[model samples]
Target: MSAQHPRPGITHDNRFFWEGLAQHKLLIQRCTSCHRLQHPPAPMCPGCHCFEMEAIEASGRGTVHSFVVAHHPPIPPFEYPNVIVLVELEEGTRLVSRLVGTPPDEVAIGMAVAVEFEQVADDFVLHRFRSAASR
Candidate 1:
């Protein structure tokens, strides 16, 4: 990971998610009232409109639901042709993250992937995806 890589802004609604990553765990938010899972943590459950929420550990397994290779307008602290992916987790929720350790051209929809954690800074960690077949 690059030292200059962008860091996530930790907030109360998603603090648990970030903390889980630091501990190398994939955590997802589940509505306590409706028992439905959601990502990009929100203050209230979208389905049941309930404020009750809880965190659940995910299997760290998912499939590539969608992806894109960024090759234009090179950005700093990031490599060219970065593979950004929308991974559909086994828990039925999706996470938007980067695909690492695999060639950009090799990425495909429905490709099995597993979560991998990287400590980008002393106090911060990020979740990334890798081909599950390689595990």
Candidate 2:
């Protein structure tokens, strides 16, 4: 999709994560106190209940933990039969993102995937997963 796609709402907590994606990097939040990795950056560490956190670069390699193919109620700026996936990253954190470059029938749980960046607009970029073997 292009600029017509809905843009992500950038905020203080997630700015770094989004910025990293624009640079073709996957950034995951880590709790400084417990060293636990987390996705969807939060204000505090879930494991230690601490506010100290840091961003760490991820390997961008993961396995498909789960997925779904949406074929009904198609939305604009998004392809139908979209393959949405929950990926368990090598870093021990999970991220929910779209899967691309593979057909829906081909997607399988525990499938190896690697992160890929798509420039949806001049100032916007999104991270998606694709078959690691295809890379």
Candidate 3:
């Protein structure tokens, strides 16, 4: 691990998400009963209140719905001026991630984005988003 980076904890429910990052793919959970896509993978369907959920790969396309520029570093390994974005995927699911490859002032609502990963450690990867140059 880089001295400037630290691994984030991965829970059982989110292990698949990290695995997908290692493969450069974006994964999310889909509710079989309601056909709604969810992020931060859940054990049950929030829409239908059912436990029937499936892990699915998303198109990796999305737009920034909202964002905030971090002025305070939470810890030593974290950096200031980071951008926290709420990206709304094409599948209609919103996920919280850091926006990369662009300045905070450049981030805007409806801005196109694609999935990218930052490997913090051998088994720890973080999913971030970048400005999508291609459709």
Q: Which model, 1 or 2, shows the larger TM-score?
A: 2
What would the per-residue lDDT of candidate 2 be over residues 1-135, giving only the tens digit for each residue?
342989788888899998998899999999989999988998988788999889999999999999999998888889979999999999898999999999999999999999999998888889999999898
lDDT of 3 by residue, 6-109 (tens): 65568877778778888877888888888888888878777889887778898878999999998874665666678899999998889999888788777889
Instruction: Give each model's whole-structure lDDT.
Output: 0.92, 0.92, 0.82
Q: Which scores better on TM-score, 2 or 3?
A: 2
Worst 10 residues of 2 by lDDT: 1-10
- Tell me which residue pairs clash in candidate 1: none
The CA lDDT at 125 in model 2 is 89
Instruction: List the candidates' TM-scores in order.
Output: 0.95, 0.95, 0.85
Q: What lDDT is reached at residue 46 by model 2? A: 78
Pairs of residues at least 3 apart in sequence or in different chains that clash in candidate 3: none
Which number leads on TM-score? Answer: 2
Candidate 1 lDDT over 1-135, as tens digits, reads 544878777899999999999899999999999999999999999898999999999999999999999998888877778999999999999999999989998998999999999888788899999999999
- Any runs in candidate 2 off by more than 4 Å, and if so which? 1-3
